[model samples]
Target: MATLFVITLIATAIGSISGLVSGGYDGLFLGASTGLVAGVAAWAVALMVAQWRRERRLNRYFSQDGPVAQHVRQNQRS
Candidate 1:
């Protein structure tokens, strides 16, 4: 999350610089704003994907034949 935010900031700055070079004041502001929005959206998507993968990994550990579950059963018998 933090990494993504940092990336977004960097992207926004780059966009602003590019716009300034290519056009002028109007381009600079517009590019910066557009970059910011795009960055945030990208961050959100990354966060969601990370969360989904984590959930999937956790669920695997909880499955009947998973190592964690097998360990639990052995401990119970002991």
Candidate 2:
């Protein structure tokens, strides 16, 4: 989390600086804001992707014969 914050700050600084040089005052502010928003958005997206991957892995493993499945099956018979 600390690393992410540092990286985000560094990226924001670079974006803002580049914006100031390439564009104008408005660009600097907007670029910094945009960098922060984009960084958080990307993190959110990555989290969702990781969660989906974990769910997929779980589903795949569950589809195989295992103790959990066996227990479930045994319960269903009772």
Candidate 3:
């Protein structure tokens, strides 16, 4: 959230400054780098693992498919 925004800002500033000082568009290019993509890849891996765990648990307990599994509990009972 806020941390990500700050990180992106820092990347953009550093890239821009270094690029302007030495090369050109290096700032913008670096700013848009895929370095953060590695982090995203890790997060994706973790999320996939968590999803698998959840699916295993659901299969064991519910023995049900989707839609039904996603069936949220009723909050307002008649």
Candidate 4:
């Protein structure tokens, strides 16, 4: 997504600048690599958390005590 791409770019820029300031060419590569990995991990975690929350909400909505279930029960008696 756009959010993930933006996060990755920001992280890479930060890492590259820091490495350039502290060390040299080698440090730049190392910092960029580390930043990329961190960005992807963060994105993955965000996706998982979103999915979990969605599933939880759906489960609650469809449960026996939920509105849908109540409506179904009402129709059954008619």
- The top-ranked prediction according to TM-score is 4
Candidate 2, residues 5-70, lDDT tens digits: the string is 666787788778878887899999988887777777766776789799999888877874866788
Alpha-carbon RMSD of each model: 1.8, 3.0, 8.2, 1.1
Best by lDDT: 1
Local accuracy of candidate 1 as per-residue lDDT tens digits, 1-78? 689989899879988988888879999998898888888888889999999999999999899999989999999999
By TM-score rank, best first, the candidates go 4, 1, 2, 3
Per residue, candidate 3 scores C-alpha lDDT tens digits across 1-78 of 455555655655665665566656665566445434544555566668979998988777664454444453332332
Instruction: Quote each prediction's TM-score.
Output: 0.81, 0.65, 0.41, 0.89
Off by over 4 Å in 1: 71-78
How many clashes show up in model 1? 0
The candidate with the higher TM-score, 1 or 4, is 4
What is the clash tally of candidate 2? 0
- Which residue pairs come into collision in candidate 4? none
Which 10 consecutive positions of candidate 4 have the poorest summed lDDT? 14-23
In model 3, pairs of residues that clash are: 15-27
Model 3, runs deviating above 4 Å: 1-32, 64-78
TM-score, structure 2 vs. true? 0.65
